[model samples]
Target: GYLGCQDTYYVGNFKGIGKVYSQVFIDSYTRVADAKLYTDKTALTAADMLNDRVLPWYETQGIPILRILTDRGSEYKGNIEHHAFELFLSIEGIEHTTTKAYSPQTNGMCERFNKTMKQEFFDTAMRKKIYTDLDDLQLDLDIWLEHFNNERPHSGKYCYGKTPMQTFKDSKKLAVEKNNEILYLDYISDSQNLTDNQVQNL
Candidate 1:
């Protein structure tokens, strides 16, 4: 199963710089989510978000995204040049899957995260009328989302009664342990190879 996932939630144009779009991606296992506001919903924007922002962020964690799950929006579908998203994923060897139409469960992790972002973050922002522009919304969102991932307790079954940040930290710990095991195996294999070479020489 993919630990990383993505989805787009439409808020429509509000104060009218353009249509309000949020590109959200969640770590499926940990429920850690990133929600970024965009003025337009286009394939190019989606591609850039994933390629330039999301994927790079994941790379910093020492793991290439194993897969990404998203809803079937036109922004994610089209021809080669037009579908820069697919191109980028293909180049990076990240498996991309789209949810079945109307079956939100197919990408339920992201779908739920998107809903939470709306209810908890965007809705709160709008209710307070705190923002004069998208930039303001963006600023507030960054702070709220940090709290959501780090301080907010995850009630999901897989969360192990921990906050998203705790779960994510655990995931990293496991990844490091797995890497260490692989290195140990490589060392053993090299030792065996050396023994064989020495035996043949004798």
Candidate 2:
């Protein structure tokens, strides 16, 4: 599964400004991020970004995403876009799930990513007046993404003195171990259930 966020920004001072919308998709598995900057955040544009940019990037990375989880955003849930996305996921045998309305915790992974992006990239760069155009913003974003994936140490108990990439690897290993334990217990439970059923039948 993966998480996504879409938000808008405005450029220039109080007198004149132009709106730029951005959407970000982060791999919940790998913590990799794909961001698109656009003049509009409509359903068509959102779908185009996902189809052309995000999915292709995932393909290149050899990440077989089984599901995509997002909030109930109008751009994602709009009829045309939602239908197209559903069909796209269906063809890939992936499921799509949406968080309950206004429940940010359900999509907390993406929310944390968004907060980090804003704090590390947007706020810092905007404060320094570093971005003058889309190209500049894209460059800064790429640099920030590299730092985020490789250098920045994630601040979380689970991260435990490792970068996000390291944390993801460790987490996956732990998850597999935990799953195996659960499976072992489940097998025991099922065996007991079967034995009880046989005794009752006798």
Best by TM-score: 1
Compose the digit string of candidate 1's lDDT tens values, residues 95-168: 87788887868887877787788888777778887455888888898999889989999997678778988888
**What would the TM-score be for candidate 2 when compared with the true structure?**
0.67
lDDT, residue 113, candidate 1: 80
Clashes of 2: 0
lDDT of 2 by residue, 101-168 (tens): 88857877777777777777877777776444776677777788878877787665556556766766
**Candidate 1 displacement at residue 147 in angstroms:** 0.4
Cα displacement (angstroms), candidate 2, residue 138, comes to: 1.2
